[model samples]
Target: MRTLRMILLAGMAASALTAPSAGAAEVTALDLGAATAARLAMGHVRFANGHDYNATVGFGSGAFHRPGDPPGTLYAVTDRGPNIDCAEIGAVVGMSAEALCAGDTAAKVFPFPAFTPTIYTLSIGDAGVEIVDALPIKTRSGRPITGLPNPLTLTDTEGAFDADGRPLTPDASGLDVEAVARAADGSFWVAEEYGPSIVHIADDGRVLVRYVPQGLEKDLAAADYTVKGTLPAILAKRKLNRGIESLGLSADGRTLYAALQSPLVNPDTAAYKTSRAVRLLKIDAATGEALNEYVYPEDEAASFTADAKAGKVKQSDVKISELVVVGQDKLVVLERISKTTKFHLVELGAGASDLLGSPWDDPKTSPSLEATPDLAAKGVIPLSKTLMLTAEGGPFPEKIESIALLDESTLVVISDNDFAITGDQTKVVRIALDKPWN
Candidate 1:
């Protein structure tokens, strides 16, 4: 089978998350669909010119590296486009999105309702990786922008198709963008698991405003560009496609940090399976309001279980993909669970605990900021974390969902190869920051 999957990706590219005890951390990776090729897409089922959209260019879902780049250049992003595996057309086990392909309604919720949503740019260093540019995401008179969804009961009212199964028309400027943050005048602000919105593009990729969350603002006002509901309202209780992955900005960009990739079906879903409180935002990036809020606990999907009694962990697995800002109010978060991935270091100081309009965003508080029990004995408190890096080896790659810190001793890391059709491989890895750069 392709030489046992290239010997299990060369033993997970020698992982153990690249030991760093004093070994001065170092890890490399590279592999990004051999740096693109053409024959893009059209009606692919698996291949034919309609496939190889270069493994759908999953673009690490969100990354950045500017500030006098040219070093190892970085800038990835891509999500909500080119989806697959609604059980490959049968879609039954634990339905999601278009209710897992709703009886194959021609694979709704996008098989590629015209993909678009891109941003690549890579380049990396130490002699490998390439791609140098890709851009797509538009609409400021430019158009494009797909990744279909939004335009119904508000958010993931999912539904779109057309590979002959017909019915295709979602995309109220669809955006499931997931984490990205860049703005020292270059603009860019991503963060959108559909309607968890937070957009703000400009600097060339168009889109100028989208905020979403308070009552879905007339379901994104007939969007095609520019929408703004302005968040909070208990984040409208998220959890459709798990809202707002992770987006950050402060360091004078005037605050803005999101992060809530799970644990909200709020008052139910059995309090979202024993809630590990998740809801972190500190906005005001020029008025989306919500100035502070905390409580961001997760990881305890039996604490990152890669495998337990062969039952392969569950509890909705866990997420909260990436958050960067590194210190001025701090944050470095990451945290994943499909096998393993970690990185902590939070610190929102001023003694944490804001939880916004508190009472733990009621859904009948009781024990529900994800089962509170004693958040510093109810004075709340949560924003404290430390760990930093934890993917301890064994051929990992189901999704490391992009992260970048590129200098101050490099850290890059990327993944979300669902485009690799689950052979899941979009390696970028780079690790090497043990210390002395903080």
Candidate 2:
């Protein structure tokens, strides 16, 4: 049966290549060697309203429009259990497409237990983010496992449920979630925009640890010299503290770098001004302590903000979507505007003494120094190289929300189909970055 399932899956994948399409410009065929050399892997989730189905693919040419795909074609693995009334969207990783398509018992893979029901970004390789086999997660109660959805089933697939099988929705108070670093051990650390700021989950969907930003608040206040908002409130705000948007970790996993999806307000400002600068934070992973926090230079911030105010930018929000530590001192940042994507190569240097400066003292005006001294004291860094608009003019204009490195030269990008009434197309795109990032 397993052998038969594998054969059928291969055939289905082959057929997928020729799936009917509305005529659009043909994209360059993916170079598998370049993709493999870059060590990229791609995956995405799908969102469907009754009339149309959209599947978001990771690292593909943004969203592809397929007006005729079946409603239950895409699948997502959730933390809810089987007894709970939920839709079976698709098979989890390692399940055969044939078995999933058949909706048979043999198609059953794993079950997600105690994992938070939310959207997640996955990593492709071992360095920062990588895939993991079915593994038990450490829990306060006991050991818990992950599960996959049966793609063939088409019941209620939209929302996640609680232990009582009640549907769990993002509350009226929006919840913030950001994909942090993929650990060397193949697990992922997610920073929340709300309280209990950190959550570590294994790839198979098991909760490991939840870190609350309690102890770090005092230090963060001391470093930035402002404390109008709590850690949780900063994370929960939809426009600003868009929870854990970017994650960067040291090679050894001791230090962490985080960026918010939107600009953090200067606590002193009455009508807070938004800056193009991305916040760089150094965290102690073991203790969940924010040792230092710094902002990118005002010059860089002005470059992007000026364009945004002039309506010359594709996206209004200068969100840092993804972060990867290249070496000890180098970091790769993926910046997303509505239709444009930019890659920035940042260089880490010594810490600064006054990272906040006048921003903490007088929010109404700009600071004297282009850069903050506290950031230097806290070991904040600068961008050494940058790549802008690397992948544009593809199938659908992308709102890239997640990214993973397949290898040194390949990257998998995922688009979030925001579950709109108009039926947005979700896409996963694979790009081969063969050239130097300068």
- Highest TM-score among the candidates is held by which one? 2
The TM-score between candidate 1 and the true structure equals 0.32
Q: Judge candidate 1 against the unseen true structure and give its global Cα lDDT, from 0 to 1.
A: 0.68
On the 0 to 100 scale, the lDDT of residue 140 in model 2 is 35
| Residue 168 lDDT (model 2) | 36
Q: Please, what is the whole-model Cα lDDT of each candidate in the order they appear?
A: 0.68, 0.39
lDDT of 1 at 404: 78
Candidate 2 vs. true structure, TM-score: 0.52
Error of 2 at 267 (Å): 3.1
| lDDT, candidate 1, 1-438, per-residue tens | 011111232335543443222222456565444335332223344322233323445677778765566668877787876665444543322234344344654344354577777776778765556787667778767888887777757434655654334567766777878767777887778887867768888878889888887778786677777777777767767777788888877767888888878877766677776677788888998878787888887767767755443366766677888877766778778888765777787888567888777777766776677666466887777777766566644444556877877676677777777565433556666766657324
